[model samples]
Target: MSVQVKDLKVYYRTLRGDVRALDGASFTIADGEIMGLAGESGCGKSTLGRSLIAIDGRMRYVGGSVSLDGAALPLDDQAAMARHRFTAVSLVPQYAMSAMNPTRKIGKLVTDLLRSRGIAPDTVLGEFRRRLELVGLSTDVLARYPIELSGGMKQRVVMVISTLLDPSLLVADEITSALDVSTQKAVAEAVVEFRDRGFVASTIVITHDLSILVQMADSIMIMYAGKPVERASTDAVVSSSRHPYTRLLLSSLPEVGVRYEEHRLSGIAGRPPSLLNPPPGCRFRDRCPLAFAKCAEEPPFVEVAPGHSAACWKA
Candidate 1:
């Protein structure tokens, strides 16, 4: 496994109480696998990604362990995680356009970043230029400031920079959410291309777009209010999901050929439960159409079919 997270719990401290952002999220991403994490807003997908790289001040690592390539990650210790940040694990955050420094030229910024990480600038020069070319950007872009590039260009630049050290795992959090359809496709393809070329071993593509996930991910994991509701291969999750939440989510998606006028799609009826003080048992119980008295108890994420797992009483 390239990445293994077991019962990882990360909470945000507030005057109200501890918001359990990531409560017992456990999964594994095999070598070269692209895992897609899908959920509605505030479902803790971003929290899970951020915890792997850097936990913000308000966030606290409550429990569980994370391992990359069989080595434990010191996620709780911000200073200690510095040793693994770029070299072992990297992130292409939600706003890739704003990730670059406004003042410095792209090339200079890369050099400064490398120096800060104790890596000599000259060491990766050839690889850097090669990566730029692979991403369809000219070497001259090195001289341009962040302001000179378009949103798509900036996103691509961030992708190249994030994978510069060839990390074992890459966390891409809604990296394509802000782009147009064509640009989004291009960027999404570039992510798979990076893995194909061994620039990164495995990747976690976190987004609420199931259609995009269908195009890029090998496996899909559905989360509902700080817990995994279902996990399976992309094909299985889309075509034969067992979990009610997964079924509702998949049904809500409008495919390219499917038109609303002919086949009007219905969205999930109720809003996602608030994570601040979420309900007892399954968090999705209130919204699940198939929820029963058994739902009063949390369902285990068990395999219903080969490579298909769901956490629902109905399943």
Candidate 2:
């Protein structure tokens, strides 16, 4: 496995109390695998992505262990974790377009970032420019400001910068969410290309869009509330969904060749339980269609089929 996360719990420090953003997430990604995390908004998919690389100020690491290539990431210590950021683990965050510094030129910003990581600027710039060209950007992009580039251009630039150090694991949060359909496909393909070319060893793509994951992810993990409810190959999740939540999510997507004039789209009902003082047992009990008395007790994420797992009692 390239990445292993066990019993990971991350909470937000709110004045009301600790918001249980990530109750307990556990999963693995194989070497060179592209794993997609799909869930509704505020379901903690983004929090899981950020927790893997770096947690911001308001986020508090309650407990968990994230290991990349068999070495543990310093989830609680920022200073120690800094040594790993962008080198061993990197994130093309949700807002990659605004990740760059507007005050500094592109090249200057890259140089400053390298210096911060104790890398010699002269040694890396040659490879850096070459990568820029590889991603369809000219070498001169380094001299221009972030505002000068289009949204897609800045996104491409961010992808290059995030992987410049050849990190083993990459967290691409909502990279394609803002782009048009064409640009979305292009960027999604670029991520797979990056994996095939060995720029990053493994990738965790966090998004609510299952369509994007269907295009590139080797496997898909479906999360509900703050934990994973189903995980399997892309084919399994799309065609043979096991968990009720997973089945409900799949039913919500529009199928090709299906006319919507007479057939109305179905939607999952009920609001997601609030993280603050969440109800005990399964967090999804209230909304699951197949929920039972056994669901009142939390179900283990066990394999119901080969290479597949779900946290539902009925699975």
Question: Could you tell me which residue pairs clash in candidate 2?
Answer: none
Ten contiguous residues with the weakest lDDT in model 1: 250-259
- Candidate 1: deviation at residue 309, Å? 1.5
Give candidate 2 misplaced runs (Cα > 4 Å).
none
**What digit string (tens of lDDT, one per residue) describes model 2 on residues 1-315?**
889999899999999999998999988999999999999988999999988887889999999899999999998999899899999999997787898998889999999989987899999999999989998999999999999999999999999999999999999999999998999998998999999999999999999899999999999999988899999999999999889888999899999999999999999999899998889888899998778798779899999999999998888
Q: After superposition, how far is residue 181 of candidate 1 from its true place, in Å?
A: 0.5
List, residue by residue over 95-165, the lDDT tens digit for candidate 1: 89899999999999999999999999999978999999999999888999999999999999999999999
**Segments in model 1 whose C-alpha atoms lie over 4 Å from true places:** none
lDDT of 1 at 1: 79
Q: What TM-scores do the predictions have? A: 0.98, 0.98
